[model samples]
Target chain A: MENEGRRKFLGVCVAGATAAAAVAAGYPVFRYLAPRSGQGGAAKLVIPVGELKEGDAKFFEFAGSSAVLIKTQSGELVALSAVCTHLGCIVQWVKEKQQFLCPCHGGQFSTDGTVLGGPPPRPLAKIPLTVTEGNITIG
Target chain B: MIRKNTLAILLLASLAFLKPALAAPVEQPETVCIQCHGTLPDRLGAPVKLWRSSIHADNGISCNGCHGGDPKDAANAMTPQRGFLGAPKEKDIPGFCGRCHPGVYKDYLSSAHGRALGAGGPTCVTCHGNHQVVKASLALINEKSCTRCHSFDRARAIRDAMQQTEGYIDDISRRIADFQVSGVDTEKMGKSLFSVRNRFHTLFHDVDVARVKGESAAINKELGKLDAALKEIEQSHQKRRVAGGIAVGFMVLLALLFHLMKKSYD
Candidate 1:
């Protein structure tokens, strides 16, 4: 009877160990398979209207990437991904040239996201933006 | 003795597989230029052979792409009727390359080099070689090469101004690449770094020290943002590693417990 108890106890210990090993290995696998929350596409960004004046520009993070909102001298609101298309360096607003200049490789783009000059294979990506009730809304 | 010989043979055989070129060669597209002249003598076939190592060749820019010939037709390939432009004159070299690299061409034209074209000045071929063109870098602006024409002081200054930023770019690029190797989703960030690096490198064409100085700050600022993002990822990875270590310890402890339980039963 005592031997039986010992056999049962050893069996339980082995089972417990196997279960522990499986959990240790499988926990990461399950976590990897689990659905992630709040990691979707860029959430909507709301900026107050008139935040940028004509000939003024502001760079901000949007959609987990660099974005720029510029009001041209003629009061044209232009929003574009500041990411340079050639290799993905954030472009700086060259106010005098009225163009976005990528410093990494000298790729230039017009405020409207047109390839002006430089090595940028394509123009800057334009982010769809709208002005609703004194605020600029961007997704 | 037999084992040693066998080991040697195996090592030599393994070397054949080690070489990537042996795995697959960079095949030249079956264009008329290649079809007729590929097997011809040195003058004609040498460029084809030399072009294999060029950046153009790697990127699939063949003879027809640049010379404007009919790639598909062998007979009408060089016949000017098929849009074949054999070669550009020294004076027109800028415009020729400018067809594709508009920005670099424009900057080159406006610089001292462009103004000196045809007047014993260095053209695109002078700095960036023709046909055998490699990827452009700061090494191209060195004393030995630039001193061939004028003083190296100005060129060296330009190189100096851009060196620190280039170092930063290289470092960030290595870090991003390492993260990518570890299965991180760094595609967007990698592309962003590339655009910035490319844009910055193109500035060398302008040969303007002041502009380089002013632009470096903006680039550094942008790079700083990337650095911050990468740092956050690294911290998360570190946390995961610590958790992994603790889990491993627990596994070892459980194994020890099982061993002790088994011995107790015995």
Candidate 2:
């Protein structure tokens, strides 16, 4: 009876230790191996400054979306979203009026992207743009 | 008797070994809890992602931090036998949470709700609630929380004021555009505009003003003057529009009279 009890106790101890070890080692590996979502990949987009005329705007596709590039009459370059704040209407540069006009609701935005009139709740969303060696890169 | 003595010794040794294993600080009963609870679905039935951004996951805090008792067995977790470290009481909840988030607790204590709580008001669970703790998102913060206190009327009033001011700005901008188009020397006007712009940039964006003394107050004063000038410009534009309309109407009337005279002569 004593030998049997001893064997049973030893078995329980070994099993408990194994279980603990498995739990400790298994978790970090599980987390590390887990697949991640929403990690946006790299994108390459480049537009020459000289190509964009004064008071004109251009659009480029990067990072799975469209970005608008505007060159003001003062020769200053700014990049903003073509997506309107009201209902996602695409805004176009109206050179005659010198403003960004959304054809959807007559929403007008200033040359600097400030909401001038109509139903836009806020200014146009600005995407960070960089000028490198006369090349305009937006993300 | 000899066999009984040996049995007692073996039992004592077994207890000794088990004591150390059991006392291993309960081994954070959450090892298994995280397997299921950690990846629980969100409200949209999608998985409650952002585990990487979570404070629990970042600081090595696990599910066991809140729901205690041994997680190895579901039965033990449910019953919560001795050595249970389960959900704390509502009163003790603050202290328990404060252990990790003292800054938030301090801020809360100074707030109106915190003062009320101190004066025997409702606990933290009163406003935030318990068990149904969802992740706070930007949309949630802006839409749900702020609107609750701000009210529709207040929001509408603010929006109306903003629109009125924006209209005045549009008139000024149009004038500036016209002046530029007509080749007017707006150098003096540009100097004033730059000053106002500098003040606005300093106040709104660059808030550190000890290094730049009197900037914030200067911005307020300059903005007041700019607003007055904008109001004057709006009035002038209104006058111009009315005058232009009158002139067009008079010209049309004269043309009509000339045609009538020509017909009578014939």
Candidate 3:
């Protein structure tokens, strides 16, 4: 009876070990093969209205990458991805030119992310922003 | 006599390094041009040899392509009625070459270089040789070549403003190629880069520093997207390494558990 019990226990051990090995190996392989999840940052952010003045600009993280908020000379607010749509280089707010200038290929973006000139095929992407009670919020 | 022999040897040696600009079929019946010229002395045959490896030759542009003639009949090969243009004058060189490169010819005509053609000014042959024209590159804008015409300060400035971005584009290209070799679907990215690179090279023809500087930012932005995509791939690779490590640890644990179970049975 004890020998039979030993046999059963050994069989269980072998089966358990084999199953454990499979799960251990398979789980990681699945994880590795699976598509990456969207790892973006905060969905929404609020900024004080007075913090950004006319002709001023602010760069903050939007989603997983950098974004820019600019106050044009006309006291208008504009928000866009700091990343250029063309090659992903950061777009600079050319305050003097009153346009977003890309350093990589001289692509110019209007305050609204519309391609004003140069090789940029698309406009600067606009981030939805809401202003209320002297506070600005961005998503 | 010695100088002639030395020149012949040099010409023959240079032929070994010649490369066609692009691929094209090289099959055809032996034409009147190649037939008679094939057995000529090195002095006359040097041009034929050089022409063989030219972009024209690769595209099957034979003696008839530029110098029109009845290839099959040797009698009327050199006859003007057969439309054989022996050689172009210095000024006519642009129009001769323009017969094919019309766009570049038009651009060149309005350019400063074309304006000065034949009157102490550099012609098409000044930079691109007669029969040995290789691919045009930024190297053509260097001091030695430009200084031959005028000061290279402006040219140097143009190159400096562009060299970093050009290098960045090249680096991205190499990265894409590496990914391709590793079985990644990088064909689209390669084509995208190629288009931008071609556009950037077109700016070289303009030779306007202000314009090049102005457009550089946009080009850089385009390259940035490619870089981000590559970076994402690299991140995935890093994740794979981490997952692989955890998997190895699990295997070790499983081995220990099996050992304990064996001891129990023993």
Q: Positional deviation of A1 in candidate 3, in angstroms?
A: 13
Q: Specify the highest-lDDT model's number.
A: 1
What's the lDDT for residue B90 in model 2? 59
Error of 3 at B191 (Å): 1.5
Q: What lDDT tens digits, residue by residue, belong to model 1 across residues B61-166?
A: 7897779988998878888898999889999998888776655777788888888889998888898888899977788889999989889999999999999998
Error of 1 at A73 (Å): 16
Q: List fnat per candidate, in order.
A: 0.36, 0.00, 0.07
**Deviation in Å, model 1, residue B209 alpha carbon:** 1.2
- On the 0 to 100 scale, the lDDT of residue B57 in model 2 is 50
The per-model DockQ list reads: 0.25, 0.01, 0.05
Sorted by TM-score, highest first, which candidate order results?
1, 3, 2
Q: How many residue pairs clash in each candidate?
A: 18, 0, 28
Off by over 4 Å in 3: A1-139, B1-106, B118-120, B123-125, B128-136, B248-266
Residue by residue across A27-86, what tens digits does model 3's lDDT show? 868978887676453579889988987888899987756799998888888788877676
List model 2 lDDT by residue over B1-266, tens digit each: 99999999999988886553233321333355555555566632222244334535543445454555555655565455624566676566655555443334544555444555545544545534444443321122223543554444533433333333334434554665555444444443443444333233222112122422444345445445645755676686688688668657755655554555445445
* Candidate 3 docking quality: incorrect, acceptable, medium or high: incorrect
The number of the candidate with the highest DockQ is 1
Which regions of candidate 1 deviate over 4 angstroms? A1-61, A64-126, A133-136, B1-30, B180-183, B236-241
